[model samples]
Structure formats: C-alpha cells, structure tokens
Target: MVRRRLFSVNDHFYQGKPRYFIAECSNYSCFCVHVEGVQNTSCRSYLLFFVSKQRRLFKFIQPRTQLVATQCGVVKRIFFSTGELSGDLQGSILIRALTREALSRNVVVKVRRYISRVVVKSQKTFQLYGLGGSLMKQEGLELLQDTSKISSIGLIEAVPHLWASWSMIQNAIERVIEDPPDIAILIDYVGPNLQLASKLRKIFPGLPIVYYIAPQEWVWGYANQKVPFLLRYVESIGEICDKVYSIFPAEHAYYQRHQIASEYVGHPLFSSDWKKGNETNQKRARESLQLALDAVVIALVPASREQEIRYILPIMAQAAKHIQDQLVDEDVVFIVPCSRDDFRAKIQQQLTRSGVSQFRIYDKTSSSIVIAAANLCIMKSGTVNLEAVAMQVPQLVLYRLSNWSAWLGRNVLGLQIPFIASPNCVEMRLVVPELVQENATAENVSKAALNLLRTKHEQQRMLTDYERIAKVLHCPEGTSRAAKSMFELMQTD
Candidate 1:
C-alpha cells in the first residue's frame, strides 16, 4: 500500500498573534493565511501566499482556502495594466489593500512584499497579472510587457518609441484574448492602455475595465474623437471624472457622459507606507550621508526616462548653478535621487560636465530620506512631487519641453493644462510655483527657489496648503475603496 496525499490543510501555525493563522498543505505548493479582525464582521478575507513553480511569489489574493476551502468560491482573475512609474506605484498600494480587505475585519492594511513564484496547485487564488515595474514585481505582479514607456507630449519626439509601444499593445491584447482575465484594470497609459481596453472589450464583451488614475480622457481621447469609442469599453474608474467627462457634453451622452466609479479613497501617495523619517530617522539619514544640520539640502528629482534626462536634467544644472551663484555664502548640497539606473551615469556625467561637484548622486536613494534632509526640492513634474508634499518639503516644481513637444500639445493635441502637478490641479490654484516650457529657465527657477528660501512665510504657506490638500485628497479608507468597488462590481449578480 502506498502513502496517499492528504487533501486537508496538513499543518498550521499562528505566526504572531493568536487568531492569525498560516495553513500549509502537505504538498507545500499551496498555502493560505488568515488574519482575524482585519475586515468588517460581514465577511472574512484570506491571502494566497503560495510560491509558484517558477519561484514567482503571488502575494495576497483573496480566495477560498483553509477551513471552508472546499465550499469557497473560485478565484477571480484581475488583469492590471499600469503604464507609467506612478501608476505602477499606485497599483501596488491598491493591490495590497484589496487583498487585505479579503481578510481584514478592521480594514487596516499593512503592505509588505521580494515576492517570487512557484507552481500554484489547484487552489482558488485571485490571480493578478499586469504590465508594470519593480513595485508591482515586489507585490508578485507577473508583468506582461517589458516596455515601460515614459510618455511625453510630443508628436515628433515620441515617434521613435511608437513601435515599442505598439508591441506592448499587441502583447496585452493577445494575452487578454488568449487567457482572458476575469476583469481588467487600466492605469494612466493613455495610448497603449486605451488600445488594449478597446481590443479586450471587443473580444471579451462583458470583461470589466478599471482605469485607475484615469488620464484626462477629454483632452487626449475626446479632443481627438477617440474617447467616445474607448469609453464604451470602460466599466469602472479609480477616480472621479465627472468634471472631465462633462467636457464632452453631447447632451445625449453615452459612456463618456456617465460617472463610472470613483474610489476617492484619497490619493494613493498618502496611502503609501513609504514614510518620511521622524527627527531621529532624519538625523540618522543626515549623519549617514555626512550632511550638516544647517546645510541647505536641495534634492534634484529629474526623471525616470531618457527624454527627461536629456531635456530636464540640463535645466536642473543651469538652475543649480544660478542658485549657487545667488546664495554665495549659504552651504548647500545638491542631492539627486535618480529614478532609473539607466540614467544614473548620465546624471552624474551631466553634473560633472556642468562643473557642479558640490553634489551627491544616488541611484537607489530613498525619496523619504532625500525629502527629510532637503529644505527645498527642484523636481520634474511627476509623482515625486506628491512624495515631496507628503514629506512636508517645500519645492520649486519645474518642467521644460522642446519647442516641438510644446507645439504638439498646444497646437496639435489642443491640450490645456491648468496645472501639471496633481496638488495644484486639486484646488484649481497654483499651490506650488510651477514653471513650464519657455518660462522654465535657470533665472526663473533660481529666483523662485531663492524667494521660497528667503521667506519663511512662503514655506509655512506651503505647509498650510499641504494640510488643506491632504484633507481634500486623502481617503481614510485608503486604496481599499478602489479595490472594494472592483470586487463588488465583479461579484454582482
């Protein structure tokens, strides 16, 4: 007689507290963990933390496991597509929250993820696969596309990368049709993401599409007469787009006319567990970097892509020089936190070429540490600005584009951006001084930085504005709002 396989949860141990439990199967390919009191009393959530055969760790997916594993329902497959770095970051936060709600009785979520994968046996696991980067990978996201296109507003400039972007779209469409995830989440990659959605909607007519951090469809899609088509495919959105949707008022409106779903759970940046250091942590960061307490630390957050390095970093160089020339006696250290490794050498090289050596370039520097040390930040208009605000660091936000790019957006695309930074856009006021295009010069940026540096009032005003912005932007329920909406829509009869 041969030893038979045990079908039950062969072993279980409470990792930390009494109620929380991790149940391991005899085969060891499948696993489940329960954290009691994590969600509301109406339901219980479970996490699938099993490693696949490939050693890819699929983080927390709520599925029927453990006690009622036999009777619990099947795992819902969520197709996620995050186009830019910010989207990837936001997607990670949203994923964790959703997984937690499946188990959390109290709704509080702790996001922790080196997630690898192995073979997942016949177990109900909410499978999450998408097109994203490291943050998603850390959450065990099976990134579909390798092309991380950092798109900019430029017809001539962005043409070279169009083929690569198209390839990504094709891959996404092929995957959706072939495997066909139960639902799809499209982050702010307007071109490829929208194309993928359009194709998936046609192939899988009822497949739900969630556009998290949904882009300005009015300008990019509607103005071009493409949005109305894409809108038909979208089933949900991560943000409120009534104001944006209203722009295309056909009076007899279609999908673009109605509000899909808004998470309003506050900005994902606020929900992020990436914390700024307290006085102690700040002090430690300063000491480790050998930065003085009185030194004026200016963080230069340039870009995550090549174009930004080519165009934006040079402007930063000029601005830094001007700032140095103006504040002759004040001690300053220009710290650059390079977003991508490909541009790290280039950033250092450019700084060196500019003969600016009173600087430190860190490829993997923590944004929190940089924010903690810096009195002010000179950054490109991106997700990093949100990090600056959360850390209570005053900034002179800036952006520059080639004449061709500027023409492309203004003349060709007919885009009217009131504010590039999200905070400024929130209140319809320039919460921070933003200089763009021709206005973004070394002189203008230095003057702005100097004014903010000299006046304590300006800094305090920013802090005050930040508080107001937080109140307007932060959601107490966190990313769970988005996650819950997605699940409820999927589970609806």
Candidate 2:
C-alpha cells in the first residue's frame, strides 16, 4: 500500500527520479522518513509529505522558540553567516531587508503540488536564523555562534589560538549539516566564511549559497584567494558596487562563466534613509556628545574588531598624540568612537597609556556623527572608512595585517593593487593618503592630517573627490534592489 501510494504521489508532483529529505518526527521513536527503496517508488512523496506534517505537529507541540516560520506549505529556512563588525552590520541589513520582503509576500518556498488550493493550508512556513552580532539578534536570527566574538584582525593571526578555535568552526558546520537551511547567505569576513562555505557545499551539494559583499581581493590582484573560493563554492554573487564588474571583468566574469547567478546590488550606504539620518543628526549629535562647534575636532576611528583594536588603537593614539603635540596652544578635541561596548575599557586604557587620556571615547553615538563632526579622520581600514567618506570628511587610511599573513598576501598571493580605501578604489586614484604596514606609523599619519588641515587647497581637492564619490555611490534603492535580487534567487533556487 505504501509503495502504491508513493508511485501515485511521484506521478502527480514530478516526472523524474524523486529526491527525498528525511524529516524526523519527535513524539515517537518511529520517525517518518524517506525510504530509498527502488522497489517502492509510489508512496515516496506521500510519505515525505506525511512526515513533514508530523514534524510540524511536533514543532507546534514543543513550541520551537527560535526560528521564524512562513505561511506557505514548505518552510524556507534561511541561514546567514558573518564575522566582524562590518559583516554584522551588513548581515543585519540584508536579513532585515529579506525579512521585510518575505513578510510582505507571506509566501512559502515549497508546497506539494498534489495538494489542491483547499488543501494548500497544509504547507510549511518561511523561517530565517543564523550566525551574527547584536543587530542580528534584534532582527530575530537564532544565534548559532556570535560571529562578533571573533572580531579581531590581529587575533585572527594568533597562530595556535586561531587553530584552537576549530571546535567552534566545527560546531557551526555541524549545526548546518544537522538541519541545513534552504539558503546560506555568506557575508564578508572572508577567511573563515570561505572555509565554512567550502565545507557546507560538501554536505548539501545543491543548496543555493549566495554571497553578499563578496570579498574585494579581486580589486587588488587576480592571484588573490577570491578566485578559487568563488569558483569552488559560491553559487551566486551579489556585488555592492556598479564599477566592480568593469574594474575586474575577468574575475567578475568567472561567476557568469560558471553559470552562477550574478547581480549589481547597490551599496547599502547610498540609500536616502541613511543619508537623511546622517544629515539631520549633525547638530544634535554634536550637542549630545557635547562637541563644541568652534573646537577643532579630529576623529580617531580605528578597527571595530578586537584584532584591529589590538593593533590599530595604539597606533591611532600615537598619531593623535603627535597631532596634539603639534598644536599645543590650540584646544583640540580628539574623539575616538568605538563600535563595540566590550572594547570601550581597552580603548580607554590605550588612550591613557599614550598620554592622550583626555580624549573622549564616544561609544554612545553613531560613528557617522563622530566622523561628521570631525575636521579630519585618522582610521584603520573598515566600514568606518566608508562612513567617513559618506560624511565627506577627509580621512587618512591605515592598515597592518599580521606579518606572516601580510607576507602571504604580498608574496604568495601577488596582491599588488594600489589604493586600499574604497572611495579611492572607486575614483581609481588616491583621493586620500593610505599608509600600509610599516608606512602606517604615527609620524606619517600625523603629517598627512597636518597637511590636510594646514592646506585649504588640498582639503578642497579631497572634498571635491568626495563629492564625486557620493555621486558614484548614490543609489536610492540599494536595499530594495538587493532584496529583490535575493527573492529572484529564491524563486529559481
């Protein structure tokens, strides 16, 4: 009877060999599952549908608290993986947009065709959960592992300790393998995520894995890790820039050549809503932080990640001290805006040790306001750089990766591209000075800031370049476009 029923269901829903997924039913020891019996093809679909219903019934009884379920019959479980401050922010934005779109449509991903419109009420719902930071928590993603905890560039370089974190990595993979989501959205924080994506593809071979804010190593050179990762793992590419395709056609074309879905989702920063918030809050932002209008304020914006703070905050402080020493009589307000609350004490320690204890560490206000209120910015490379650009503040960018990692990125990888900063990359020239590795010392940073402040002509030139950057980056519907593309991926997915 089961065999006969399976054949009837297969004939109704699809034509080819039926693919099956085992869904465990909780109440009893006899979990309903796919019997891969070549002798019993008839009842396959019917049994699977029955099992899914039983699982839903089990979930309802148990009251699964974490995952969000959609209205359609087949539940669309979406998982996102991200590590680092910027990745957390981008991941949060992407999920919010996806949820908004998903909720608006109120649609499920898969429903058995054998069921009529009257019976369609039996379909499973849409749900999303995954790994990320504080923002993701607010958006309702089940925290798989706090990716924010790994938010250190220098810590990533710590040899044995980094390897010791492999158990956490294994846990992340096991969670996915145990009950995989329909879609896996991998944000930036390339190294670990690429490793995870590669392993994930092995478990769920055909699962649609989409990448947003895809690594920009291609912007530097063809020999970067991006080529192999994209070729081996990613099924789709969602870019943040319009010029990326043109800038790296060979690398960009690799996605198309492999039949992977590709899209030019505009930068998330260019949206009107973000700009309005940045624009409207300038005065209040200053007042709330008690920033005097006439005071000369220079923002020391460093890395949001732990490794970044470990390496960058000290150097940024050294530069700030240099700038302050040069302007002894002038009342200079040095504002260091931290991204995470956990790092606030460490930041205060660094400032105190550097003899810059008087500097205000504003963790309460947005980095946008800090950058907006500043005459100049001395920062490490990250979202903060773009935030500075978004606010039209002239900035000096700096970066220092771990020695061995830096050597590999240069020697083994052959990464010789110029312009580390995003705005500079977009402009195809140095709109702002970039000091990397050894060149990112306090004296060099202080010198650049001094020149920008002292020379009005150079400042104007940089500001004009910023205007062009703003124009290039402006996409009023960036978030909407990204959301739309994700849906398109879902439809064919």
Q: In order, what lDDT does every prediction score?
A: 0.63, 0.62
Error of 2 at 298 (Å): 1.3
Residue 44 error, candidate 1, Å: 28
Where does model 2 exceed 4 Å of error?
1-73, 108-125, 151-161, 221-260, 272-281, 402-413
Mind sharing the TM-score for model 2? 0.76
Worst 10 residues of 1 by lDDT: 1-10
